[model samples]
Target: MSYLDHCSTLLFFVQHCGARGRSIGVLWFSLPSWAELELGRAPVFWKTMNGLPPTSGESLTLFYNPAASNLAPNEEFGIAFNGGFNQPIMCGGEPRVMRIKERGEADLPIYTIKIQAPKYAVSLIFSFTNGVEWDGPYKLQFQVLKKWRNKPIIFSNEGLAEELSKEGACEGAIFPDSCDHRELRN
Candidate 1:
């Protein structure tokens, strides 16, 4: 096994054994460097939260599903968005996901997601219903968003907004890695 070297994203598995089950805990996000990342929306959040929880409250854990993942064969690894969190074991709550559609220069197949955290929220609130259609093999490079149907309320609960406050979405998962569970398996 690889010892904890740097701080990179750690895709974990959700397993329940002896009733308690094991949570793949905080995704160890080891960034390359400060300048290399866009870590601008973290600070103001208050609470522990992860969009996709390990245990679904019913003692059921969410494992990584490879088949449902989207991978870029050209790229070495898959990158998914992560909802803001203060530190390991603590979640920053749900973020604001912007649903953008460009027109002329707007229709250039591009979009943006933003975020902000509220006070006293225990989990991240999100809407998986927002989606973007792609074209060709390159499309696979982008991960599929669940487009959470109920986003407004989710954000409100966590003090996150889809309006002027900010716009963004956290990374999710990729293909091949068993840690991804966007789509379930039989």
Candidate 2:
């Protein structure tokens, strides 16, 4: 099967297995360096964490979604995350989804999804349709706030925000320190 097809199937399994409280041993693969750069800049993988997790106030909004106008034909999207012990598994609870829409006349379509994970660190994987046939499977990593309420919480992608961002939502967040099979690559 093609690499993208394989990734789609694996993501499907991950989602299904997660829903059933099952864990799978996933193998890791590497993509070409060019593909890695492209995946990093894709708007579909653009993420932002609006505020700190609540200690007892209004919930913080986490934005994870694709940009509508930038989608290529036959595009498919999937997301997976390692929710810290205190958080719910991916797809476990209701998350507010924002559909694709145009932002004014700029033609930059904005799509956003909001999820709340209180008191837990999260490691996120975003998968998108391959831009090149032989680019192999491509995925990018980002994480939510790892330290909450002055306490250090551990998750898969701990202390990754520094490498992925210099400013914006992911600043000071956590992410995987290295690329491996668990990453979204074929």
Candidate 3:
């Protein structure tokens, strides 16, 4: 399958699993080598903090480094979430439209948008975007904020488990059935 096809498949799965009340702790975006060169490195989870409660008009803000890899003199990069096409949150400068792909399955519509030359800290304003109120029991919080220096944040599954443990939220963590050892041993 083509790279775009692969992305679409993965996105569909993520949305599907999320619809089933599964909170995706980590998401890996597989970009083609060329796209990677243009978009920089894979996304890293910087930090997770509390946001406005459900009752509040606005929620959490997720600050992340959009691009940590090297970029050409004027090369641009941007990220699109599964939601409405609203104004981009300017961290340093305004967002320029790169591309937009409209797609739908059954009755669900999806739009893939790419922004050119976005700020290092790209803020996803939930209040302005269109989507579900929350992902599973957790409200959709976390906004991206710009940093003085662009440094990549590295994290692992173990680190995530530790964070959850510290929060006392890992007690009921569920392992996927696909992780069963019987098939692996076979």
Candidate 4:
């Protein structure tokens, strides 16, 4: 099989196997850096959490691409809380959804949501929407770790409000490589 075919097969396998929230072992394969980038650009049905190991009572920035689905222009992308150990998973009394806009000047409009993680929550469950359809019941579990580590935000979850103040939405995927969940441990 050609390299692109292998990449497509791997993506299909990951998409199917990754949905159930079951952790999968990472399969290592050698590929040129350019080929890896090519594979990474293919959009996948997963959400991106700006920071790693989401903690309780902190800023959580999330991105969703409406172009990935057959969403109408009138539809608003949003998140619905599935209830959690602490009941509400939002802090600072923010709304469930922020808004949708273009990250750059060109690309599919990405839906950006910002919330303060609940201080008392141990886990979170939520889903995505394009006003007409739903995407996930994605779950996140948090642990109290003594050693602190932080992953740099791969995508800029910043300046969303200002961008919304301006006109138009982006036309493509912003961070095609960032995938947040394949599994969640209960």
Candidate 5:
């Protein structure tokens, strides 16, 4: 969970979450050093986080199950994706699918998706594009954008980081601080 100790360049990343691991295929670019995190606890509340301050260039979205976490438990969460980051976000169907590039061009050059979740439970996933990872000891946070009731945004760090109190959401994690971060040789 490199949610802390960052690492990544970022060009908009997206994830489809559910009871299991990630349902929809996860597309990611190895940032220089970074990983993403939500405002609160697990089964993050996406809509609540999206409404926060908008990241400079990247678009942050949180997709989740309205009934997955601790709420309904019957209805399913929905989210979808479109490559080239040129497609519209559609939240429907279980295990929402996103178009994928051919074998050779496996790297996701661009894309976007929307995760739809219910009010009580938190189910937010985000996609970030164009970001330079940061080294922390710095203060950042996820906030519910004042404009809307459930939108969240990562402040500062250009979506790479949000402005908030360091409550230790992801300290001592494996991501940006993974042993892989130990300067390897090719």
Candidate 6:
């Protein structure tokens, strides 16, 4: 998880760690490929984590290549999730079908995807592409929680007094000379 801090914009660095357990490893230096790098930097893509930790049966929206990652006009961009491969996002009861929305900054094409998060899934894995080549096996972990009501417990003062009298804490416990169970009853 390394980043290049360029003018406050953090660019993600792809550290290809081999089968080793640790992320620290030798950097496999190589020439830049058209699909991997752009303008001396990795083609940047955007994803939203606002609806994360979503319970079962919730829809999440993800935006890809909103700013950078200049794809060729003919190149098609798509995402593959854990459940399916190269699946099209369902928008307004219809699949967007590789359509680009030019509503992003600088009129850049932003690919939107809607995911129906399942309750049984532990994590969501996503792979992206630009028609010519593919990038990423980006993972989004989930913390599944049971649906529960927010009920606060309130203890009655009279109930506390009755319980304290039954225990008589100062009898066997160490305390100051002024310590008295009667004071707690009051």
lDDT of 3 at 66: 27
Query: Which tens-of-lDDT digit does each residue in 77-97 have in candidate 6?
Result: 343222221111111121223
Give the Cα lDDT of each candidate. Answer: 0.22, 0.29, 0.24, 0.34, 0.24, 0.33
lDDT of 3: 0.24
- In model 4, which runs have C-alpha deviations exceeding 4 angstroms? 1-52, 69-95, 103-106, 145-186
Alpha carbon deviation, residue 134, candidate 3 (Å): 5.0
Give the Cα-based TM-score of candidate 2 against the true structure: 0.29
TM-score between candidate 1 and the true structure: 0.21
RMSD of each: 17.7, 15.5, 20.9, 14.5, 18.5, 22.6
Overall local distance difference test of candidate 2: 0.29
Leading candidate by lDDT: 4
Task: Return whichever of 3 and 6 wins on TM-score.
Answer: 6
User: lDDT per residue, candidate 3, 86-108, as tens digits?
Assistant: 11121112222222222234321
**Top candidate by TM-score:** 4
Q: Between candidates 1 and 3, which one is better according to lDDT?
A: 3
Please list the residue runs of candidate 1 whose C-alpha ends up more than 4 Å from where it truly belongs after superposition.
1-26, 31-97, 101-110, 122-186
What does the lDDT read for residue 181 in candidate 4?
17
For every model shown, the clashing-pair count is 37, 2, 9, 7, 47, 0
TM-score of model 3 (CA atoms): 0.21
lDDT for each residue of candidate 2 in 1-186, tens digit (9 for 90 to 100): 445434532232112122222342343333223333233332333222343222221133222222322333224423222232122322222222233433467434434333222223333333322232111122322233324333454432243222222342231222222212123222
- Ten contiguous residues minimizing lDDT sum, candidate 3: 83-92
List candidate 2 stretches off by more than 4 Å: 1-70, 73-89, 92-98, 104-108, 128-186
Clash pairs (backbone) in predicted model 3 = 61-142, 61-143, 62-142, 62-143, 62-144, 63-143, 63-144, 63-145, 76-117
For 117-178, candidate 4 gives per-residue lDDT tens digits of 43334434444543444444444444322232132222112222223223221111111122
